[model samples]
Target: MTAGRVVLIRAVNVGGAKLPMARLREIAAELGAADVSTYIASGNLLCTPPDDPDAFDRALEQAISDEFGYFREVISRTPAELSQALTDYPFGEAPSGHIYFLTGEPSAEAASDFCSRDFGNGERLQVIGRDLHIDYPAGAGTTKITAAGIAKGLGVTGTGRNLRTTAKLIELAE
Candidate 1:
């Protein structure tokens, strides 16, 4: 019995760690998730579990440690929860692969500070409610623009993936 959770794992491929995603699905299976699926090589998992997300988190963490011999920070959100983050994004779909970081709700003061800062690459930042929607028309792998800089301005810890990752997450949730 799989837990109903959307799990996002980070730093899997760092330093050529060889953290096979197939093993990740197997770990989810051991955690008692029934309908287990992985979104991409970036380490996103959509699973239906027998227990609630809290239990799944613990079990999955332990399983991953035992299997991989390392600890990974696992963030789990329900599809509905992530859907709200997507809805709050303000950009009107400018580029196909625009990346946005879904971070903690920035304080009103922090948001105000970010409104005035420039990203050095002529990039634009918008805060729609709690979510930070960044229009990176230049795409990732560029030296000038970065999601981290935007997160720093907003005072939150998060990462952004391409638009392809966003669409797949939505599709898996559906």
Candidate 2:
């Protein structure tokens, strides 16, 4: 049976790195991903994986790099994971926020150390599993805590999605 998943593509369609959403969907379909759909222009895909989730992730990542010549980090999450993430949000109401999913698992000490550090500019962080929930009241664009910064601080690479986008992706996955 096919399972639903959300594929998060890192660092594409920005800063002159363009990967069209239509092309992305096509690639997923070519890789036997059924019910392929995209959320925004930022490479969020909702698809039914024909194989194991991890294998599909690696294949999709490889296909994108081979066809588009852009090596982007691709991560996938099941619908259940997305639901749990929403339930685990650890901040007060915010004007804007993002959820960053780490590419690699971080040690408990590393996660704690990263969360303990001050990311000033009114940014709050919490590590839940490999996911980091951050709230930036002012705006994420101006925050000192960026994807790269989080990676450096926690020793794990990650890709982030705005709260709205993330919610929509979960809805689509469902």
| Candidate 1 vs. true structure, TM-score | 0.74
Flag regions of model 2 displaced more than 4 Å: 1-3
Instruction: Give the Å error, residue 141, model 1.
Output: 1.8
RMSD of every candidate to native, in Å, equals 3.5, 1.8
For model 1, residues 1-174, the per-residue Cα lDDT tens digits are 233667776557675645778888888887778788887777688888777776786787677778777866566777776676666555666573343444367788887888667656555666655455666566545535444666577776455655557666867866
Candidate 2 lDDT, tens digit per residue, 1-174? 234988898989998778999999898988889988888798888899888878888998899889878788889898888778877888855658778988877888988888888767777888989899888887887777767778788898879987777777887777
| Alpha-carbon lDDT of model 1 | 0.66
Off by over 4 Å in 1: 1-3, 58-66, 69-71, 96-103, 127-130, 143-155
